[model samples]
Target: MSPEPLQTGRRRRFQEWPNYRWAVLGLTMAGIASTSFPITVLSASLPVIADDLQTSESAVSWVQTAPLIAMAVGTPIAGKFGDLYGHRRLYLWGYALATGFTVLTGLSWNVGALVAMRTLGSFIGAATLPASMAIIMTVFARRERALALGYWSAVTALSPAIGVAFGGFMVDAFGWRTIFFIQAVPSLIALLAAIPLLPDTARKPEVRFDVAGAVSLGLAVTGLLMAINRGPEWGWGHPLVVAGLAVSPVALVVFAAVERQTADPLFPLEFLARRGFVIPNLVTFLGHMAYMGTLVVAPFMLERSFGITEVSRISAALIARPVGFSVGAWYAGRVESRLGGRAIMIVGALTMSVALAATGASILAGWLAGVIALLFVAGVGQGAIRTPAVAGVANSVDDADLGVATGSLQMIGHIGAATGITIMITVLGPSESSERFFAIFLLAAAIASASAFSARWSPGLGTARSAGAGRRSRW
Candidate 1:
């Protein structure tokens, strides 16, 4: 017999292996993290970047903020496109384009150039979220989705913490440009692996793409996110912010009208009515407001309230929450079968809320240990809810619309994060008073508590029920 037949047989068996999905998960995550980790790494070294480029820290912040805003606006559209085309194609294409932009980001000569490159990279890279989620969901069995999503959530949660943990050191040792340059290598490797390893998803070529709906919805998200993002910076009364606020509702109304009239809508209007779908998104929105709000404030609190000046100590403290989040998400993914989604989410939210409230007290009392511990607990709480919530949303939607559903969820979460960051900063203002820190954290706690309360409305489907739903929804 020829060796060619033997080689073909081995390749077929490898593809048929059940654990191949894990390979898919690992590679795609590497691609996603490669593009994303740089932004967070840059966050820690904004002062360095600003100084290098002859600009202010505030001006350099656009390197982070603009990319976030771009991702918020672009993700859903990219997801819808992925569904119309194929997720595997989009994942590879998006990452490949993003890798090129990552290199450009490293080579940027000025702040404006860096911001533009990063924003464009993130905007195109946004496709990876829905595409990766859809791919993983397709590969994993229904009962296994929670665990898969849990690991996915853990990576997403931990990457930023890891970036912040090492970002400052890397910037000081190697300079900021080298970071982006190095990031591109992993992305390129992932793109290569994906060419053969990732499974091709079924595409819906017959369905007419919803151009009008996509445009109007994109406009609406852009307007609303821009308003929230810029309102604090430019002042709420700034004409551009006001215009953004004004445009959002009108664009939303137009989007609703377009979605209704379109033959193939970008998003299914009926999913809005699903308790499983809506509640997780609502909880995510509120939870992130607290989670990210605390993240933005902790460094400042350490300096102002705790009087801690060491960057290493501050970085160590800042890493606690996301590290906690990574652990909680990992644990939740494993036990979702026994504890159920609703219970886990409620517990997570309540835990976060209580921890955040305690954090405020810790800061006021200047107990650095307590503050670090509380932040870690807050992170765990947020992480615990994320995997179950994402898995729940995936189970509720049809297999074909998984990308759109997950994309929309991601977009909402990003919007919530931006809003939370903005609100915390606004409330904290320039005052170094511990009382101001306390007030802002309490506000965050209240918001988190509201999220906990909202979780009760979510579907209580455990792994079994979710599995049943997944079977019924499969394309």
Candidate 2:
């Protein structure tokens, strides 16, 4: 169905609920899928990439890690960039560069070359995602925001899902090279789609890049992100790696202090103060961390433990998310308007925790059906939290600041995912079993449950009248 068009005072996309909003959303969805697809597509092809390029698993892992780290570094900054420069140019360049890099990765002759190529895509992928959220939130209004966000979130979720399935197909058919080659098509499509649809929003001329603030965050984020990504290979004890870990906390402390003092903070203090904002973001961090931590292990459980082929396992695991995410998000918007954003988020978080716990327990008990069911349940939580979270922030902030706020949330989410993966590798030992894995799943469940409850903290529902005032003091 065509989505309601953007509210441009013109009969845009068929008098739909979110008319032109739908067109923008379509680009956002496509962009997200493309960001995730490149990485997931390469995952099934990791073995293939390693063999042909004479590389190790660690090297191939960079194809995924580089982009994630780049995203982590770029998301918040890019959000502000979107706010200042406009989402259109950044989104276009991001997708265009991503398509270029995908091509580069495809033709790479060695692991080093592939990583370098992936880095370029990673940098571009970095720009696309958070900006997509910022652009959507800024354009949509309070009432319809959540639902629009929900569907947008679904598309983002689906990208990884589709990539996982598509990756498996390409691997099973031609070879791993098809993963990169196929990704080029969607990236190009997104770039083309964004051109006519994405709105033109300009930045304030006085708004300058916080170079000092940027450096502080860059140093801290790079240190932390590098440590997290490398934990699997570095044994968490290497001196350089240890420094990266040890310095991150201190650096962040310093960064926070600096942000608080700077005339114009890189991340505004008021933005973080809203209870709804803070809690939802925290919840997002935990959810991403837990799910990402487990994701690396799930393919193995599907293929090795359950005796499924790579393709079926990929499709089953992935396809469920897009379906659930899209449906749940669309519904949540309706639910949020009637019940409140807080309620919807709480429900999502709780459902996620319970589902993960169930999935783990069922795996322990030899119940394949249970695993499938729980995965879908986790999607329920995802659908619930994501759309509402974005919409709530949009409602809470004035139109002008929406892009920055969206960027803030996304950056936090990326950090959480990175940190979770780090924890997973750190916890690794020889005694992995369904039972042990169940324990880990329960831990993941706890994170999900926490996410559900965190909704109460957002200022989205509060009566703070100041456009974006007083919020700076609270966080």
lDDT of 2 by residue, 315-418 (tens): 66655645566666767766676666667777877877788888888878888777876777777677777766666665556666666677777777878988
Model 1 CA deviation exceeding 4 Å by range: 1-13, 468-475
RMSD in Å for candidate 1, one decimal?
3.8
Relative to the true structure, candidate 2 reaches a TM of 0.88
Clashes of 2: 23
**Model-by-model lDDT, in order?**
0.85, 0.70
- lDDT for each residue of candidate 1 in 1-475, tens digit (9 for 90 to 100): 2112233354456679877889888877777777666555677778888999999988898888888888988898899988889997788788888889999999999999999998998899899899999999999887888888888888887887777766667777889898887788888887877776777788999998888898888788888888888888889999989998999999999999888778799998878767878888999999999999889888899999878888777887888887899899999999998888889999999999999999999888888899999999999999998988888888888789888988999999998998899899988889999999999999999999999999987766436555545223321
Measured by lDDT, the strongest candidate is: 1
lDDT of 1 at 264: 90
Native-to-model Cα distance after best TM-score fit, residue 126 in candidate 2, in Å = 1.8
